[model samples]
Structure formats: C-alpha cells, structure tokens
Target: MAFREGGAIGTALGFYLIVVSILSIGIGPDLAILSKIAPGVLWGTLLLSALLSVDRIFHNDYEDGTLEVIALGPLPLELVAVAKATAHWISTAIPLVLMAPVLGMFLNLPAHGFWVLVVSMLAGTPAVSFLGAVGAGLTLGLGRGGQLLSLLILPLYIPVLIFGISTMDAVLVGPGSFSTSFAILAALSLATVVLTPFAAAAALRMNLQ
Candidate 1:
C-alpha cells in the first residue's frame, strides 16, 4: 500500500508480477521441466523481489529527520545502521517468506526444501539489506541513487543469493549436500552482520552532515 501510495508504480507492479508468476506456476505434464527450472526461477525471484526495497531505506528516512537522530545517537551509529537495515530487510523479505509457499507449489519442492527456502531467506536477506545499506548510504542523498544502489548492491549479493538458492537446488539434486552452501551463506551473512553496521552508520552520519 505504501509502495503504491508513494507512487512508485513500476516497482510495485514488478513486485506483483514476480509474486504472481512464482505462485501461478502450473504443475502437471512438465514435472521434469519444473524440476529443472524451479531452482533458477526461485532464486531469481528472491533477488528481484529483494532489490525492490533496498533504495527506499535511506532515501525515505533521509527525507525525514529520523535518520539524523539515529546517526547522532550514542549506541554506535553503525549498530543503528545495522538495525535499521535489518528492519528494512524484515519489511521487504518477510513478505517474500509468506509468499514462498506459492513458489514452492510451482517447483513441487519437497517438504525439506520448503523449510530450506525459509531458512535460506532468513540467512540471506540480511546480506542483501546491509550491503544495500552501503549502497543506500553511498547514494543516500544523490539525485539518482536507486539505480546506482543496484549496481553497488547486486555484486555484493550474488554470492549470498547463489549460496542460498544453491542450497535449495542442491536439495533438489542427488541427496543434496546443503551444508557447504549453507555455510557460505551463513559466513556471508555473518560477515555483513559484522561490517555493514559500521559502514551504514558512516553513510548515515555523512548524509546527516
């Protein structure tokens, strides 16, 4: 509603199409084709869906004064940045989780992979949000920051997205060794967990001034 009310019609539409297509995938004569295509489409949907909300973080809050108070707060600006970015992620990615059953239906994903998608998104979206914070921080006050934010964030997120979807795909394959990909996703998320706060806080502080 906010996305629509805010008038970013194109983005809202993209979000809708993604949700619809993922949910509406038919499951009948194309079981083999579905298995082959499911992993890529599921992964692609996650990436595209997440990208929609990254720019709104700093861009919206910066316009208001909330970002300033947060930057100047005593609890360490980076920590605040991490928290803020996480909140942004929650807003965007949680909805995707709720929508996962739809994507799962299309893939005919097993019960195990169904839960895996949930866990992977949980592990994965933090990387997206925080790294996006870096991009957002860099472009916090710029005239055309959204596209630049994508350029900055997409590279950082590839590994996170890959490992996450890879885990799901691996599950689809021969007995699925998810530990390795899962570990990489965890590592990436953890690394971002450590670093993005400070980076985002710096961007917030810079924008504040």
Candidate 2:
C-alpha cells in the first residue's frame, strides 16, 4: 500500500527538501549561523514532513473497510498497528532520513555532524511513525482531524526532536557524550515502538465500534 501511494512519499520528501532550502535561503549566507542551527532545523523539518502523511496511516484502511477485515483476522489489532506503523516508517521516515544528508548540506551542517545527524534520525524517527499511529487511529473518520492530529502528536514528538538534536550537538561540540544522547533517542524510539501500538490499537477499536 505504501509503495502504491507514491504521491504521499513524494509529498513528504518534497516538504523536507523545500523547507530546508527555504530555511537555508532565509538564513542568508552565514554558514556559521546555518551550522549552529542546522541540527534543530533538520530535526524539526523531518518531524513536520513525517506529519504530512501520518493521518493517512489508518484513515485509508478505515475508509476502505480493510481495517475492519484486518481487525477481525486472527492477528491482533496491536500487531496490525505495528504493521501499519512499520510501513509508515519505511515509506515516510526512511525516505526523510535518506534525504537528511542532502538537506543537511543546505543547512551547512558540519562534516562531522552528518553521520551523527543520520544516526540520530535513524534512531529517533521510528517514534515519529509509531506515536503518529496513535493520533491517526484516534482521529480516524473525524472531520479536519489533521489539525487535531498535529496537536496531539507534535507534543509526543518533542522528546525525540530534542534528543535527536542533542545527539548531533554532542557529536559536533558537546559537553556530553554522543552515546549518551543517542542512547536516549534510541530508547525513545524503542519505547514508542513497544507501547504505542497498544494505544493505537485501542483507539482503532474505539473507532471501529
């Protein structure tokens, strides 16, 4: 399904590139300023780009009755939630992560920080997809739920964003070790991967009823 929805992936990737390009232009030619803010900007834009398609995670399935059939199958809804979120991670987050290096160049991201930025994003973006599934499931079938979904999910994304940037900063010029922050970011992703499916599954059940 994710592969079939090429436009959605393109939209997310385009959003990531366009936002980074605009920010680079807006920041003027100051490489110093650009590098200083690069980590935050990259992390923030990636999260927003991921948000662009999050509402569709379950919305299409729900609308087409595929969700009902999946829910009734022998597999648990929590695993279904996991499957959907994993597909989202592959379709959305991986593309964004792959593009981060190119975008990071626009932001004048440090050479040393490139590897850290990629690693941090890889560690943290799963939380974005998994936690987003919860909001997607909660807002399923609602009118104009995208705005509410943003409200509900962006807060949950903060820790991931913060740790992600911190991981970059630590690698670039840090008071703390890179492993420390990266571990926290990875832990956040793991926690969401383990827990949010249950929450998303419950939300789906409520909506299905």
Candidate 3:
C-alpha cells in the first residue's frame, strides 16, 4: 500500500531533505553551531516527516470499508492495528531514518554522533508509528483530521524525542550516559508497541461503528 502511494513517501523524503538543507543554510557555515544543533534538528525533522503520512495509515482502508472487512476477520483488531502500525514504521519511519545520516553530513554532525544518531532514531521511531496509530484510528473518518492528529500525537512523541536527542548528545557531549538514555528510548518504543494496539483498536472500533 505504501509503495502504491509513492507520492507520500517521496513527499516525506523531499520534505526531510529540504528542511535539513534549509536549516543548514540558515545556520550558516559554522560547523560548530551546526554540529551542536544537528542531533536535535535531524530528529525533529524526522518526526515531522513521519507525521506527514500518518493520517493516511487507516484513512484509505476506512474510506473504502476495507477496515470493516478486516475487522470481521479471524485476526483480532488489536493485531490488525499492530499490522498497520508496523507497516507504517517500515514504509515511512525506516526511510526517514535511513536519510538521517546523509542529512547529518549537511549539518556537520560529529563523526561519533552519526552512529549514535542512527541508533537512537532506530530505537525511538517505533513509538512514533505505534502511538501515531492511535491518533490515526481516532480521527479515522474526520475531515481535516491531519491537524488534529498532529495535536493529539505530537505530545505523545515528546518522551521519544527527548530520549532520542539525549542519546545522541550523550555520545557527543553530555552529563548523561548514552546507554541509559538509549535504554529509556528503546523502552519507550517497546512500551508503545505493546500497549498502543489496544488503544488504536478501540478507536478503530468506535470509528467503524
């Protein structure tokens, strides 16, 4: 489904690159300043890029009654939600994560920080997809749900963002340990993966009714 919607992925990647490029240019040629801010900027841009296609996670299926059909299947709705969210992580978040290293070059990210940035984002982005599934399911059929979904989901993304950046900063220059922060970030992803399916499934049921 994601590949069929190539424009969405392309738009997200384009947006990611453009935002990083603009910020790099706007911040000027100062490698020190760029490196200092690179982790935060890359992570922020990644979150926004992932969000671009989130509303569409269930929208197409919901609109065409496919969701109802799927709900009637033997597999439970929670599992269905899990599948949707997983697909989203693979299609959307993975691409953005892959692009982060290249973007890091633009921002003059410290060599050591590059590996940490990628690892941190990998450990953290699953929460974005899973938690975002809840928002997408809630706003399933609502018009202009994208705006509301952003409001609903971005707050939930805070912990992931905080820990994600913290993990990178710890590696680059920090008072904290990378292992501790990365552990927390990974825990956030694991928790969301375990718990969000139920919330998303409930929302999907309400909207389907």
Candidate 4:
C-alpha cells in the first residue's frame, strides 16, 4: 500500500526498463557480443533497479510512525525487518525476475541460458531485498538518502551480482560449474535471509531511540 500510495511502483519500473533499454541500444545490434556481456549487463541493471527503491523500504513507515508501532508489536523487530524486505522483493524484484527472460532476448541470450538466467535471478534477488533492508534501516528517515543508500548498498551487492552472472556463465561450462555457481548464489541468499533482518532491526532501533 505504501508503494502504491507513494507512486514508487512506476518510478521503480521506469528506472529499470529505461536503464535496460539504453544498455540494449548502446550495445547496438551485435547479438554475439551482446550475448557475451548480457549476463553482466542484466545483473548490473537489476542492481540499479533494486537500488531505486531501497530508500523507500523504511522511509514511509518511519515517517508515519508505523515503524515504531511495528517495533512495539509482539513480533520481534528482526521479523519485521524480514517482512519489509520480503515486501520489497515481492513488489520490486520478482517483477524484474519474471521480466529477465524477455529482457534477455534483447541481449540475444541463447535458449539454454534463459532458464539459467531465471534460476540465477530467483536465487539472487532475495539477497538484494534483504541487503536493501539493512541499508534502508540504516538510512531511515533520511529523505535524501537514495543516493547514499546506493553508495552504501552497492558494495554489498557485489557478491550477489558476481555470483548471479557467474551462475549464468556456468551454463556454458557444464553441469558442475553451473551447480557450483548456483549453489554459491543460493548460499548468499540464505546468509542474507538469516542475518540481515537482525542487522536491519538493530538499525531501526537505533533510529527509533
């Protein structure tokens, strides 16, 4: 409701599609090279797309005092953080994950790599959401922290981005490499899922106090 109420849904989608469209055009009509760089380009764009709304994760709730109420709820704040991140993922990242294959077409992705792309994104995007929660919590109530959030969070996003692209690249190498890369990507997601909620909740408490 906050996302729709604030009109950020359009902003997030626009930022994502526009960045992707530009990259597709800038790379020109060369399908071969496009295929070579597609994974990185797509991953990079997804990073930026996720960044577009990271600040919004806690901004509205913090502004309207819902966060403090959430803090006082019977549920642990860490779980609240998880809920926030989960909402962001469902609203923002999942759409991108679903659209990746269509966007992959612009990059001339091979038929085999399409499923790899989808699987890699499925494993990686949850990390993006979870990590963004930490950043959002840290920067809570900073009306202008979108840029700062990007700076603070982009570094943390590197591992997911690297492994996500590698997961796709692994497709060309064989089953072993593919599984290895995908496993690492899954591990990253699991780690963030387990750890970031606590970190984000702590940050929220700091701001609340």
Q: What are the Cα lDDT values of the candidates?
A: 0.71, 0.91, 0.90, 0.85
Please give the RMSD to the true structure for each candidate, in Å: 4.1, 1.3, 1.4, 1.9
lDDT of 2 by residue, 116-152 (tens): 8888899999999999999999999697899999999
Q: Using Cα atoms with residue i matched to residue i, what is each candidate's TM-score against the true structure?
A: 0.82, 0.97, 0.96, 0.94
Of the two candidates 1 and 2, the one with more favorable TM-score, higher being better, is 2
Question: Which parts of model 4 are misplaced by more than 4 Å?
Answer: 1-6, 173-176
Q: Is candidate 1 or candidate 4 better by lDDT?
A: 4
How do the residues 1-209 of candidate 1 rate in per-residue lDDT, one tens digit apiece?
12211423246346845664645454444766765666666666777667777777677668877666655667777766766677766666666665765666766666666778888878887887788778888898898887887788887878987888788877767566788888889899889988887887777777777
Ranked candidates, highest TM-score first: 2, 3, 4, 1
**Model 4 poorest ten-residue lDDT run:** 1-10
Ranking by lDDT: 2, 3, 4, 1
- Compared with the true structure, model 2 gives a TM-score of 0.97
Q: Between the candidate structures 1 and 3, which one is better when assessed by lDDT?
A: 3
Worst 10 residues of 2 by lDDT: 1-10
- C-alpha positional error of residue 120 in candidate 1 after TM-score superposition, expressed in Å: 1.6
* Per-prediction tally of clashes: 1, 0, 0, 0
